[model samples]
Target: MKKGTRTSRLTVFVVTVVAIFAMIGIFAQDVAKNTTLGLDLQGGFEIVYQISPLQEGKDLPAMSAVAESVSKRINVLGVSEPQILIEGNDRIRVQLAGVKDQEEARRVISSTANLTFRDVNDNLLSDASIIKEGGASLGYENGAPVVSLKIADQAKFAEITQKVSEMGTGNNIMIVWLDYEDGDSYVKEAAVAQAGGEAKYISAAQVKSAISGDCVISGGFTESEARELAELINSGSLPVKMTEIYSNVVSADYGIGAFNKTATAGIVGVALVMVFMLVVYRFAGVIADVMLALYIFAVFAIYGGMGGVFTLPGIAALVLGVGMTVDANIITFERIKDELYAGRSVQNAVKEGQSTSFATIFDAQFTTLLAALIMYIFGTGAVKGFATMLMVTVFCTMVLNVYVSRFLVNQIVKSGALDNKKTWFGVKQSNIPDVAKRQEQFYFGPFKKVDFVGKAKYFITTSLIILAAAVVMICVNGFGGKGALNLGIDFSSGTKITVTSNETLNTNEVRSDFEALGYKPSRVQASGDKVVYVTLNQALEQDQLTSIKETLTAKYGIEPNDNVVTPVVGRELVKNAIALSLLAWVAMLIYITIRFKWDYAVSCIVALVHDVAIVLAIFAIFRMEINIELISVILAIIGYSINNSIVVFDRVRESVVESRKPKLTNADYKQIVNDSLDKTLVRSVFSSITTLLPIIALLLMGSGAIVTFNFAMFIGLIAGTFSSIFIAPQMWYTIRTHVKPKEKKKKKVKKEKLDELTIPGIND
Candidate 1:
């Protein structure tokens, strides 16, 4: 390379790095500000509705229509980017992230009816059952839009109105549910409002007269609103009854805690990883950190572009994403070091290392991508948010690691500044051998040789013991024993209320408060002494709900947030979680089988199961509340565990290809596994360290729910790294040993005898 050319290339590299960071600094805040924050990050509430036909077998409208209806309902709330998802066939999950007052939001969401007249206590007096078909229409009354109804039974209407009038002046109005169904009550609607925006309530002011032919009801409705109500009644378009099966409300103070703590944790965690890279890999580590900045910027930018919600789990994903992206760089740089150890020139090592390791990085990233896809498909609420962020992170990491990172590294290498430096690439001086004198098939790796394959039995036995221990703990604590896992309201049928007060709350005081209300809380936990979480054994009735709300509001001056999960929704969540896990497992298994072989796939699955079992065992022992977040954690571990297995198997396959082996013997397989482990052992360790750092930050700094999640993730990282080294490859070796290859068949030769012809026309 000419000196001038080297100078020019180095200049361009320096200029590019500065420009990338400059752009990142300028646009990062803009992107973050644009990105939406989830209810878990900002104050809001989330509800999952289980919809059914107002009348059984009546053929409810399509989920799309219901969603559209729900959208129309939320549009009135003035919430920006509210998330409404239609889940499965009969469920809709609505998330109002920035809803200031959920009272109106709730009221607008679940108020559905079929023109029923009820009292304040929601006792039904009359319904549209007596109204003649097409009796309802839009009309103007006193310069306001009103709904006109022509009654079939004027006598019945007069009697109902007279009864409503008798309730006295202040409470004389009948609670009306226009175009609503009979299954729900206004009291329940007022408290629950499980689905809102459809039901219209009219305060008749006073039923001054009994003689009424066309009853015109007005409550300051818009013409469009009155017209839709009248049209719905005339068309008899019955609104689908929505049952609030599950709801999670995060208080503003609660969300602020998560936001502040997690933001601090993520920043500190990712910074430590960057510093670790620089310290260990020297100058190359700086390059990795530079690219990592770009990677983070890209994730936020892409997610912001796609209108992805930012959540605590999403921040966790980004922090973990930094580790995984760093893993790619470690793979590439380590490959170059290995090549340099084998006496290749720095430029040759750079090109060869990238060329060989590209596929492995893709394989690792692809498997995790598969899990993210499945999670996005089958997950709800926080899991879905995590999956969304994960998918974006996956995309950014893949593109940056494959294209940008490599381009930057190659440019520097071609500039010839790092020509003969060993330590510059994180390789020791003694690692490279004398080219003329040394004559080994492969150079000894950086680490001393360890026969990981020979210890397969011990590793498997250890994992089995862990699994057995987990099972025992679960059984002893579960069902008939101690009630098994600490099931959250998400996986159990109950209500969880969060109350915030200006003074620090005593758990015993909170317990007594609930007890005074004719209920004893199953559990009472306090956060920062000001916020308290109370779990009840069952969902409260409307009156009970009202009493609790009034009581808490009077005492605390802030309404208590409640989460109610029905048994049916709980069972469905468990079922869907199991199905989602199995589906992800099967999908990854199929991919591995197509990529490698069945034995490798089996080993990978076993390792994944082992990792999950360990996590479950730890959680059970620790009594962590098992919730929907567990499903997300398990699926993520599956993706991550399989990725580790794939990387190991990739290296083994690479070694065999280099050997040009037609078939592998037991000894050959053992040698391959051990050699591959020896080569990747350092990379795996470094990868684990980088990955573990962010999660360690999570466990140290995150709040309750996230602490639990990150602890599980931390366990998974350790298990994944350990299994990739000791268990997975060892399992592969053992499987290969037991399953012998079929011997090739030998062919027999045939002899030919020559015959002579005497003449052209005669034969002998």
Candidate 2:
């Protein structure tokens, strides 16, 4: 079990990887058993009911009482984990996690069982069921719209009818109750006469006086009934009469086609990166790629083990992560190449490569991690998912690039693999010659100092104005009706439709027709030119769905090839997204502060906040619609931005640690920070360029509202890079001088001048 032994270590590592994969398989089964399938993955039904607000001038307590009463009715259905909660105003959102049959789910949700009792003259009497199902119009009986009630089986309808007849005066008093199973709303009403006499059973009207005029129907309520009722009431009340806002039966054909294309894209991206590595670095790159493959195995094992849902955005994150994983190897392998080219012996080059690239790897990884942490902390829904994926990949890549790669190279060197006349990996042995024994002099490039105080007022003032306006706009819009930012159906409540025609059709034609029908669709795409997923806002009722489908059939000559679809957003899901985002940020702040110091933490937070605020401001300024995709884009940009700051900070920290012999002045340290920024500029610009391409493609070629999200990301990417270089470091200086001004001391002249040199390429 010696930690450094080669054979033993490799065996353990291999075994560990195998065990994790094994566990993942087992966990997959478990997840299949308990994991709730999202509407997209498994054909299911989701019905959202908006609980109506209280009547104008109603007391808060009364509203609470009503909500509670509604909740009780939903619980009676016995559906486990029914998501029910109050939304903005009087709206409540109810989510039934899984229901296979869409039609059946809809029937249960929209049927309002407003059981009531009425006398011959049709005088209304107390019944909560009637209130719950108030929208229904009872068919005419004896020239009056008379509501009928389904007498409970236990009540003995015949016996009750007889008893009420004997008790007397019934000129047609009818009892009404809603039957939840079939959309069969009005059952026949039984006549009722007297109150005191026990008639075995009486019309709901005759029994209205008892049970304190408020009754809870305990028996005959099915599991689905409770669930539906809960959703109806939890969501308060329907807005606009609960019309089908949107619906689409996902064509299995389109789903499968998209899956194939996505899978192909992923494979291609990975293959190209792998090929690049092999051609560029030869033996070391081969080793890196092999380890890179292993890294993929390990990362996926983690994803599966964590029950990470494979989604479109998730796929994007994975692919992006795959590309980024190569970044470290590129940096390391390039360093090794540089070492060999600079005339270092194989052993010396190997050793130097590890030591020299340590800072770069550490700096890059740490910065990226910092950004991921922020996104995971502050992002909502899909943003969180994307951030989590990025974070996991970052961690795994660090191991593969630094530790695993280092060990492999070390083993090859120790075994005299590169001692041949020609380098073991086809490199020339004569090319390896010792240059410097000391590790102190390895430099990425020349360094320069930069400061912001000279233009501090302009930057600060403009930033504040932008930030303030964003705040004001957000307050006015209130996230497009919610306190939080508006999310697309990807994270917000919504339905999705994937359609495939018998023949090929233009995607724009399909999208135009859908838009004309008022579906506000986004992410519309054609696969094989015949199938498409036209994402739409969540529809709450069957009518809304029918309306959408009718339009598609009438206009596009395409029927939903599968079943009709509706999706409901649960309160818990939204809560979790918000909570997780907040938690991630707080956790990151604490961790960073503890590892570094509170001062760094404060500066990082300021910059991060500034970055986020500016992003929000831009969104507001453009009047761009922000959705879950947009949120994810913002988070991604934030991650990139924070990495920029972290690189500068890491350099400052290293300089501080190295200068312990004779402490450098603040000015001298600033110069060190400036140099670090300059040194890493190429990497930053390159990485940013690489990252921006896909997003830019998405913006240019992607459908509908996805462009809004992409645009937000585009702005954020530029802003994040800027803030990291200008905002964070400058803020750090400002805070240090103002908050701890007394700590300032006179600096050495030369050191001070060196520190004051301007950072290259940064705008004044």
Candidate 3:
């Protein structure tokens, strides 16, 4: 290589790396700040409304209309990116992230907002029907805020005023009610309205003369109150009733604290991964680390640009993404090491390694990306956020981890920096074999000759024993006997509140407080020095919930994270999660079948199920709460875990094709499986470690719901690695060498018997 050419390539590599870092550094904060956060990450609330028909026997109200109503009402609250989604045929889920006033949001979203004009006797003269759609406006009346209305029917307003005026004395009063339900009268609600109870009636006046065309309702209201009244009126009334079937509210304090802690943990985890690469691969490791950084930034940038809701699970995904991202670089580096061990030149080895690793890396990443898309499509709330982050990570891995890392390393290889010392790629000088007499049976990896297939029986037995023990434990009060999986409010339909105080809290006191309000908690546990979690068996009504939250805040100096799930919503959530899990398995099975074969696909599915089952079993044994996030976590583990089996199977396929003979024996197939695993085992371990480092960080240092996410991820990673190594490939081997031959023998017997039947002389 010419000195000038090497200098140019090196310069290009440096500039590219610097530019990426510089750009990210300059704009990262702004993007992060501007990026939309989910209710779990930012302090806000999500409410799922179940709508019923306005009148009995009528068809259910249009979900779209209710969503529209919610959208208009929340829009008036000036909340950004309020997710108002119409779910199924009769539900609307409104997510208001970064919203401060939860009570107001709930009221506005569900209120009927029926404007009516009536007398003291409650005789309705006019209602919202006579008011123009956009007629309600906020204005000032004698320095007090008032709502002005443009009456569509002049004679109707004039008639109401004249009737009220002729009624005489204390009986001649006109009343304006926002939501006038039957049996509500001026006399009955007048004292309540004066004492500042519910703001059902906006304003009332004793009419001395008839007026028409335009009128103003003055209630000595503050500007905010007047503005809310105008917005409610202008948003138009919806006849349908919106019942809050589910809700998740996180206080701003908890959200911000979680964000900071999780982010710090992620940083520590990623830093550890980068350091691991640097120590293992040296200069090549540096390149991998650089690319990993770039991949991280690219994922965040894409997610932020796409207007994704960054959530607690999203943070966990990002951390796991770092670990997953490292696998891309690890594969190539290990492959390069293999080429070096085969006595290839530095440049040639770099080329061969990248070429060999690309297909495997692409296959692994594509499978994960496919699963994430399914997750995104099927998931809601935090799970959706996690899916988005995972997709971004896999996508960025495809680009940066594969292409960019390869390019950067190629730049170094082409620059001739490591030309004289090929060991810089991590292979030892004495390890490179002589090319002139290369052994035909040479195993090309760093793993020892362990005879993985020879121990298949032991591995399978161990797996069965552990699984059986888990089942037995569950039947004996682990999960199946006592309470299965410790299902969170998301599945059980109740209220779970996490109250953070300025000082230490007594669990007994927390229980007493709830008991004081007539809500006996199912459980009260202290989560931290200043935080206590209270679980109620019943989901509270909206008003009752507001009162409880207000009381808690007043006493604790923090608004608790309140989660409420109704039976209807909980059932639906559980149903959807199960269906999505099955769908993911089916999709993965079909995909693997197309990519590999039926045996490998089936084995992969078995491994996936095993990984999921292990996580559930462990969580059940430990009595950890399983929330909605588990759905995404399990899917992510399956999607990511199968890549291990896929990688090994990919190697196995190559070995099978290369070792094909006229008559191959079972021992030959066994040797093939063993040899393939040996070749890929080193990479598998490295990949898993690199991926798990971040999750371990999250598990140890993270806070709130994220710890649960990371804990599950951490266990899933181990189970996935174990299954890929022990169970999946062994199952495939058996199906191939044992099962297929029996079917062949059976077919042969049937064919011979048919031949004997067809030729009667042969049978005699």
On TM-score, the candidate that comes out on top is 3
Q: What is the C-alpha lDDT of each candidate?
A: 0.79, 0.53, 0.81
The digit string of per-residue lDDT tens for model 2 on 1-764 reads 12356465566545655564576566655544543332333333333344432244543444354445545544444444444444444444444433334555444444443433433433443344333332322233444333322323323444333443444454433443332122222222221123333222222444322121222323233444443443443333311122232233333333444444555555665666667567656876677667666666666667657756554466566666665676676656554654555555566667866786677567556656765776666553345567778888888988876787677667656544463322534345444443333222233343343344355467778888887887777677784674344444544555656565667878788788777776677456564466566655544355666677677666556545322223443344455545544554565577567666666667777777777778778877555544456556555654556666665676555555555345445676456656656655554554455445555554544432234555676677677666766677777666665565332233333331111222335411
Candidate 3 Cα outliers beyond 4 Å, as residue runs? 59-62, 120-124, 140-144, 152-156, 163-172, 191-199, 436-443, 478-481, 741-764
Worst 10 residues of 1 by lDDT: 751-760
- RMSD in order of candidates: 11.1, 11.7, 9.1
Residue 50 of candidate 2: its Cα lDDT?
47
Estimated TM-score per prediction?
A: 0.83, 0.58, 0.91
What tens-digit string does per-residue lDDT give for candidate 1 at 396-435?
8888877888878878889988875757988777767544
Lowest summed lDDT window (length 10), candidate 3: 747-756
- For lDDT, the strongest prediction is 3
Off by over 4 Å in 2: 1-104, 110-176, 179-262, 275-288, 291-308, 323-545, 559-591, 597-599, 602-624, 660-667, 682-715, 722-764
**Comparison by lDDT, 1 against 2, better one:** 1
Instruction: Rank all candidate structures by their TM-score, best first, as comma-separated numbers.
Output: 3, 1, 2
TM-score of candidate 3 against the unseen true structure: 0.91
Deviation from truth (RMSD, Å), model 3: 9.1
